[model samples]
Target: MIGSILGDIAGSVYEFHNIKTKEFPFLTPQKGYTDDSILTLATADWLLHGGDCATYYFRYATRYPCPLGGFGGRFREWLRQGQQTGQLRPYGSCGNGSAMRVGPVGWAFRTEEETLKAARISAACTHNHPEGIKGAQATALCIFLARDGKSKEDIKNTVEAKFDYDLNFTCDGIRDTYQWDATCQGTVPQAIRAFLDGTDFEDCIRTAISLGGDSDTLACITGSIAEAFYGIPPALHAQAMHYLPTHFQQIVAEFEEKYGPKIH
Candidate 1:
């Protein structure tokens, strides 16, 4: 929810002009929410009101076609086709878009199995590629585990064992070599590593951005998990909500009220 949206907005400005160092402003005057936030809200809406997840995705994309960072090229085409033919089909994409927008599925479900199923449904709408679905499930499961009071070590091991994503590396170790990779295989593990390195919610977003590869998506993924693990600071939450739309803010409020983590 707000955690994922905060990450998306905070990292929006840095996606193109990537900063490798963690020493940077958390959010700039130029920052705004991207397709990540839009789709995440779409996911939340879908979870709140039961319907075809694809329909929610298409509606959201149609409503906010020109977001700050814009939708991925393949997803753009998917939207185009869905608009023309009234058939919203999966595009077999393996992009990080699936993982970036999957935070709500983590919070909305109670069991690990249900979370994974919802995550799969979310990703398979467009990112039907095996890696894409795996990325979403892995990310959602991390949030589930974190919110369930699992230890960091437990989360790392569970995600690694379940999805085959290596959480063994650190963000600092890969900072120099990591480039702008938009793929799920390249992005999701790194995002997880960023979360693993964080001390708190804000720190997680910073660490994900410092990796400098698809910053918003990375931070979005990291922030979702971090929120479940550490909860958001009240001040930061209020500040970030100012950037979101009225509808999105409403969705966040409703979703958080019903399913958000009860951080201790």
Candidate 2:
């Protein structure tokens, strides 16, 4: 969960710039958390409270309508509508929104089947599209495998076989390939590669942001994998927590209370 938040905050500034190199500044003091952190915290809160996901989603989103960093317009609209109507209807969003905020699902479940089920449930609360749900599930699965101490090669092979995503794109080969796409098809696979290439948690995040396109989502994807593999370093983990607001800290505490110390 701290991995996801750090990824979001670190990559926040570069979400639009799309730099395609591994040689960019990281951990600047100016960086801050975004909607990714807010929603992730909300998801954790829901799970901790033992409440319905949709109910907590609407509740938190309504109470904190304008997060420190804004949400996508459609999601904001959904929150408004759900608040007014008290109905949590599904919307079709294939954006990285699902992938960016799905870290807690990986921690809540002990088995792969349970992890996938929780991931689907968490993603379906807002992003009902199949790809959206799949992206979330795939990320959660990667984190689960990483947390379970799978080798990078084994993790890559397993994810490639089960998820059917194109993992052919290599970051080393794409030093000059620049594109501005945030779709799951465009980002998730490469993000996985970045994790595979990383030596540790910070390396994974730096590698993802260096790839440049949709940096935050890529970082989120890589962060989840890195956390699973290396766990969060104590110093970086402490620093990541500071980027979050007080409300989000409460949510993290609640998550730890329910889900057992985040395991890392």
Candidate 3:
């Protein structure tokens, strides 16, 4: 989860300004946690306390209400309606929003089946479309496998076989042609490829952001897998905490305590 936040903050400045290289500054003064981090917290919050997924998601999103959250149009509308009516109904979305926020589900569960189940629940809150659910499940499953000590080759083979995500392209190949895309179909495979190609957490995030498409979400997905495989550096973790609020940091601490990769 902290990994995902770090990616979001690092990629935030480039999401709109748009860059195509990994050589950019690690972070900018304007960098801050975005909806990816917020929704991930909400998912963790829900998993720990036991509540309806949409209810917790809506509750936390309302509390934060980040206008620059980078939510897709339909998701933004869903949030608004849920805030007003105290209800959230799935609107059949296939956006990468479901994938971007699902990192915590991988950490919170013990078994592959459990991780997949939790991922489904998390996505069903808004992204009930099949592709959206697949994206979330695939991401969560990758995190689970990586944390459980699967090799990158094994992870790639398993995810490709199970989810049919077509993880064949090199990040280098995708970088030149990749445009701003927010769909799971367009984004998740590339995010996975970023992790597959990277040697470490920072490299994985740099790889994702360098693709020049939906930067925050791409890095959000990449960081989830990278953290599981490589763990986060202490300096990087401290750097990320500097951008998060006390409330977010508090939950992050709690979740880490319960699910470990505990900070020293």
Best by TM-score: 1
C-alpha TM-score for every candidate = 0.98, 0.92, 0.97
- Model 2 Cα lDDT, one tens digit per residue, 83-162: 68878887887777788778888888889999899889988888888888888888889888877878888888888899
The 0-to-1 C-alpha lDDT of every candidate, in the order given, reads: 0.91, 0.78, 0.89
Residue by residue across 175-258, what tens digits does model 3's lDDT show?
A: 889999899989999999999999889999999999998999899999988999999999989889888789888989899999
Indicate whether candidate 2 or candidate 3 has the larger TM-score. Answer: 3
Q: For candidate 1, give the lDDT.
A: 0.91
The C-alpha stretches of model 2 lying farther than 4 A from their native spots are 257-264
**Predicted structure with the largest lDDT when compared to the true one:** 1
For candidate 2, the C-alpha RMSD (Å) to the true structure equals 2.0
Q: Give residue 109's error in model 3 in angstroms.
A: 1.3
Measured by TM-score, how close is model 2 to the native structure? 0.92
Ranking by TM-score: 1, 3, 2
Please give the ranking of all candidate structures by lDDT, highest first, separated by commas.
Answer: 1, 3, 2
So what's the TM-score on candidate 3? 0.97
Weakest lDDT window of 10 consecutive positions for candidate 3: 64-73
